[model samples]
Target: MTTATPHLLPGTEIAIESLPKVSLHDHLDGGLRPQTIIELADAIGLELPATDAAALGAWFAEKSDSGSLVEYLKTFDVTTAVMQTREGLERVAREFVLDLAADGVVWGEIRWAPEQHLTRGLSLDETVEAVQAGLDAGVEEARGAGHRIRVGQLVSAMRHADRGREIAELALRHRDRGVVGFDIAGAEAGFPAGRMRDAFDLLAASFFPATVHAGEADGLESIRGALLDGRALRLGHGVRLLEDITLTEEGGSTIATLGPVAEWVKDRQIALETSPSSNLQTGAIAAWGDAMVDHPLDLFYQLGFRVTVNTDNRLMSATTLSRELALVAEAFAYDLDDLLALQLNAAQAAFLPVEDREALMDTLIDGFEGAL
Candidate 1:
């Protein structure tokens, strides 16, 4: 069923919710609907902060607004708890896809750590299978509802956990079945991508792609490890990549100098999965400034960096891809062309084959052209 979506853009009749968008860094565990969470939790005798859906949603929003990444992550405990069962996982995943479809996400890569779903005697493989089943159903459901949407799973290994290699293997095992790529998520400060070197080595050997959570809770050294060790083709919440860009104002114009790291990321055109609301909530953009306009996405885009907007955690940030796009457009004063460029950047960086990605690009081009 298509959920009703309010137009995020106010004055323009162009509905941002109907625009073609690709989400590269959405989290499976972080995108559950509040009412679904209530039902799922009730099924397992789990205690929730609030029994009512609205209050529960408010709790998540409030908890996530703490401006500390560590503090913000505590809300996941409740979400992950309910997802321990097959039913819980499937329902959440199904609703997740429906919500994305309603918000006009044409392509999305949903990431989650399968290891966390093992508390109910489910093996890692079982967890992946459960989620894949849900994703399959969701895709069909969305299609049946006359919404053309596609979602891929990015199986993530929790960096704070020691199951990186195992999760990578699990992802490879299901590559043909819905799983699209691999990632290492969770806390990023202490656990750099190098800490999962064995996992990265195997993923590298298997010719699999990865997108590491770097430059969010940490800095340049962490991003360096993601590229050099984790072999990441994309940076999750890489909002901190701005640390490498030095901007100096001379007279009335601004002069920007790219540091070695920024230059490399720019030259390689590696996609930065930037989440505006999430970044601000977690203080990821503090150094740049304390506003959404402080985000470097516009700067990155204008400078020719492959930048893609994302909702790192929809539930945590309480955001949809459309809302994120609207906020970015408002912050940067972007027009429709800028939006098309962002979608094209994401389509190009997708883990699919070159032909498939080009096809996605064509779809976006046609869709955006039609919108005009």
Candidate 2:
């Protein structure tokens, strides 16, 4: 089910979509298919801005490109509206995985805030169960279709909500079932990771891992809070971490100096889950410039930081993981080796046992070698 028009690596016939991929920062609510949204909305007696699938899809892409996170987030209202019921959630989750499989995502961590879907009498645990059920079905469907794919849930809590502790507990309850990790996502400006100290304390004490949404809508302090307070092993949309590095031109060569925060992230190999198209859309990389080439991800990669490419919201950005990689490859002049390196970075940073990670690396290496 790959796209008819392949997203190829620049100057090569290899379709990027055929490459094995690991997606670290995809949102569940943000990746629904347009026709699915329309059908789900119709079932719930919900009115949409557009009844046509293509038109509705265009609306989301248009609204998301507003270059303001808050404004961009407003599009979620339509998507989330149709996802309140168990049937809606299950269908959306199933389709999400199938889509990922078609795009060559071998492993993906799908994240969403349970609290947002509680308005229709579904408890947090119930919602998690529903999504897991759908994910399990999706995995089976993919396997039956001759695709090698796996997915895990990363339960997230909305930062604007005061239910951090509650959401953390919910995630822990289902840790053995399907949930792999926890996250705090929403507006990252006023709601620093420190606001959820008690929740992080609980997770830290229990040896649970978390990735905080930082260095995107906010700046260095937000990233500092994510690392120091949230105990984040990964920084979600951490594009702005580049601000900590001072760049200089010397003797016709560029030299970069890492500030304390940058040093800690780089030294510790904290994975930066960067989304190139979404970063430009949400203005996450505005300080650098307004194009894909201006994204700090290439700089981070060149600087030896654990840089991983992701499609933050495929529907919103009108992109796929393959398209994101192709865009980065085109912008940064990356070849197959560079693309493999980024996927290896993602596999290494995955929330899996060390043995599993090593196996994943081997899978990636085999896939790349076979492609060559």
Winning candidate number (TM-score): 2
Give the alpha-carbon lDDT of every model.
0.89, 0.93
Q: Looking at model 2, which ten-residue stretch has the lowest summed lDDT?
A: 1-10
With a 3 Å backbone cut-off (N, CA, C), the pairs that clash in candidate 2 are none
Residue lDDT tens for model 1, 137-194: 9999989998889989999999988888989999999999889999998889999888
Candidate 1: pairs in clash: none
Candidate 2: residue 310 lDDT (0-100): 95
**What TM-score, over all chains together, does every model reach?**
0.98, 0.99
State the lDDT of candidate 2 residue by residue for 111-159, as single tens digits: 9999999789998899999999999999999999999998999999899
- Compared with the true structure, the alpha-carbon lDDT of candidate 2 equals 0.93
Q: Once model 1 is optimally superposed onto the true structure by TM-score, how far is the C-alpha of residue 13 displaced, in angstroms?
A: 0.5
